[model samples]
Target: MKIHMTRILTLMLAVFLVIPAFASAAPTTKGSAADLRSALGNLLGEHAILAINTMQKGYDGKADFADAAGALNANTDELSQAIASVYGDEAGKSFNTIWSSHIGYFVDYVKATGAKDNVAKQKAVDNLEIYRLAQAKFFATANPNLNEQELAEGLKMHINELLKAFNSYVAKDYASVYTTEREAYAHMLMTGDALADGIVKQFPTMFTGDIMNNPASDLRQTLGQILGEHASAAVFAMQKGIDGAPDFDQAAAVLTMNTNDLSNAIASIYGADAGKAFNPLWSSHIGYFVDYVKATATKDNTAKQKAVANLEKYRLAQAKFFATANPNLSEQQLADGLKMHINELLKAFDSYVAKDYKTAYTAEREAYAHMFMTGDALSEGIVKQFPAKFETTTPTVPTSPQVSTVTMQLGSKTIHVNNNKMMMDVAPFIKNGSTFIPVRFLAEGIGAKVKYDKTTNTTWIMAGDDKLAFWIGQDTMQLNGMNKKVGATVFVKDGRTEVPLRFITELLGWNVAWGKDKATIIMTKAMAPASAAAHNMATDMTNMSAGHMSH
Candidate 1:
């Protein structure tokens, strides 16, 4: 098992990057104690997410943490930076030390598990206990008149649950691991609730002074609901992964249920309609998975073929769902999003099938973790789109932005181009909306077979010798030979010809994605010759033999 550089880098990058913290303050002139509390609480929630995400990734066989773990660390760093921004350098240093230690304990657990040493494990656990005490102490000191005992108790429960989750993974009892992880998550909600309660109780006037009466403060309830639902979803995904259940419905149920949580969070920040739109679209994903699993189980090639045919149906419905949810989003943007979600699920399932324990873990980490980011993006987009209902209500801090555009990074240059361009530039073609270049391009680019169709003006892009053909035309596409319409109207924009950006890249057998309104076309060139003498390649980019994309 050779771990490709892309996957390794992806794993590493996923665990390290931090997301910007968004702690809503009163639309007032000065920073109040309530603002500080909100910031700190938000930071804590963010850290909790990161630490757990990282630990899960370690179990998955990627880096020491999941990609979300990186987001978590980034969150902690942001918190420290935020404190420094408002407080001072001293406060930042203090925050960093306390925060980093908790992350350290998680790393220690990883190190112990890697070494398979009990003494080291116990030492790590003991250190975490100490760290936990100090962690609570630090928070108490920051907000002195705070309930130190209650905070400590909450911290203890959090640490214990995390420890139990990790230890169960070490013990290879995945079911127990997921269960404990859920409880740990549930504990976080309780702690968050307690903290919110304390805030209301202390100031009396802060929470509209009717703190006692408003036990279900929208802020507290919203946070609790968001966090609790996320935890449950994470646990469910983990449980399914570990259970090795072949039932797609069960796995999809876990994903679908979580999507509901995500939808509610979005609704809280957006509105009812936006949330409602998310349901069928969200459910459709489960439907696709269910279809795929059923096809996979029958061991019938015909069934598998039919199941895959549903990919287009799934993609369109899913894409429409996003468009309906956020009308402002461009068709291209929505299409890219749909592909990303599709890729994540497929890659995740592939890892499971391959028994790539490490990759499986990474997929599990993603399944459990990425929703917050999704919720956040949808919420933010909606917040910008609509204002009144969510004026005072803060958006649940979202995870990192979803990979929005596809890019192609080969050697030194990270190129920006659509999937169609990449496919046609490297391969031969009909030169209409389907930019045809050369068959050798697929072979050179990512080892997919490129066959021509003189009779029908089609090009068949196949992964290996599989019957699957990525069929393309001027106006339509048949991925593995099923007619499917694309989001972007496939047309020749220039003489070179242009196809729907994502379609061509994916057809070329590359992992295509959208990030920050850009395209990311990642292709693992497994067999390209190292020496020029071994392979001759001199195709003019300006004018290939294939029909050109006449503007």
Candidate 2:
């Protein structure tokens, strides 16, 4: 097995690095009790992830606190990042250092235990208590405005909850493990809320301006409601699939209602028709997840294959829904999003099946978090296309663009034009000079700024002033702005375009160099001040004052 003590040790380091310690709550209008609670929950969740990751990694070894500690470290890092987003760089740095060390003590204990050194283990555990006290005092001093005694109590609660959860995991009481995990998660949320409450009481205005202060307006609430519904439906569907229950229809109806709530919220942010399309698409996903879970329970190979097949069907339907809901979406764009979503679910399910609870929960956390992205994507698309509705609203930001094509100049080399979209994905067939790209892919991926003229049998690449056109089966290109023509063939290969890569790059004003030995393509260009440069250089330190305390 890939699982081993060494792997567990590695994971322990990760947990210590990622998870942050709780801190005293300062007054922030944006901070809330819920915020505090979530922080605490995340702290516990981080421990669970590492513990589980450790157990999975060291399946053959004695599962212990070392695994838990590694996960805690990783969670601290995650918390530090989230804090950096709120507070400034210094705060995150401070948190990473402080929270990370506490988990180190746990590792010492684990190593001691492995060596059968009770005295050393006892010393390590005692050291943990001292470290806990120092941490509590650190928070108290760090945030002078917070009630030190109250903060200490909260911190103790968080540590105890986490310790208990870790213990259950060590005992291999899986049900208790999960229950404790959830409890720890909940406790963190509570602690976070307490901290946030303190802040809200201290500084009402700054935090109040953000929707985070309003429980009714909170996006997390919407996500929780929708996800809860979806999860319930999924669970029921799986049970029905397993028992071959006739009452499955009833459960599905309830699930639909839950999905309806999700879609309705989406529609409110998007539109009615978009919401309607999302309902079935969303429901089908739940059905597929349920089918997969059922197959796993029965250890049914054929059933699992059928479930995977069903997943494909669900993907197409989901893709179609996205296309319909987001009219501006191209087929490639839809396919990319669908593939990511499908992969995430599969990864989470695989982790769950393997009893690798750490990865499973991590995947769950990611999946839950991603739903917000889904909401944001749909919202942004609606607002961008139909500016009349969904204007002037704050939604979660989308992921940064991974693919970009820019123009550059190198003296006489005066490089211009690059279809970077095509260049990036030629891994399958670079042996042949011509690269094949599906026709529908152009509309979805490469950027939606492209147009396909049906009557003219030409495809237009909308970049800047230069609009390059290519027709089928001919090695000729036409500039839409200018009547200038260049030699390049757009031949049909397996229902895709086999166009000239150099021709596309030159059109985009970029120098493209290909390395045959390394199978690498490099594009160089000057940085544009109009985009990423103009943005504030300050590390996101919006809520820097709050991090790392017990609850």
In the range 1-551, model 2's lDDT, one tens digit per residue, is 43422123223322322343232233221123333333433343344334433432233253332433444555676666544444446766876776676566656655665567889878876776776666656555555434444444445544554455545555555445443434344344444444444443444443332223232223343343244324323432444344454445554565665566566665554566776777777777777777777777789878888978888777777767667666866656666766666666667657645656466545544544444344334434443454432121222333342233333221111222244323222122321223223333332232324576777877765443334566775544544321221222366554445454433432332233333342344443222322331121111111110111111
Least well predicted 10-residue stretch by lDDT in candidate 1: 542-551
Candidate 1: stretches off by over 4 Å: 1-46, 56-72, 113-117, 189-281, 287-551
**lDDT scores for all predictions?**
0.45, 0.45
lDDT of 1 by residue, 1-551 (tens): 54421123223211222322233432211123323333334445545545655676675665324444555565566666654543357977897888678777778888778878778888887887787778777756665334454356556667776777777776666565644544454345434434443443444443342211121222333333353344334333533443454332343353554555555544544466776876676666555555565555555668656656676677777666666667755556656655655565566655655555456444544433343334334434544454332243211333221222223432212333324344333322222122222333444443344565656645554443232222333444443222332322343322223343323432332232222322223332111232321121121110110111100
How badly does each model clash, as a count of residue pairs? 34, 74
TM per candidate: 0.44, 0.42
Residue 326: error of model 1 in Å?
A: 11
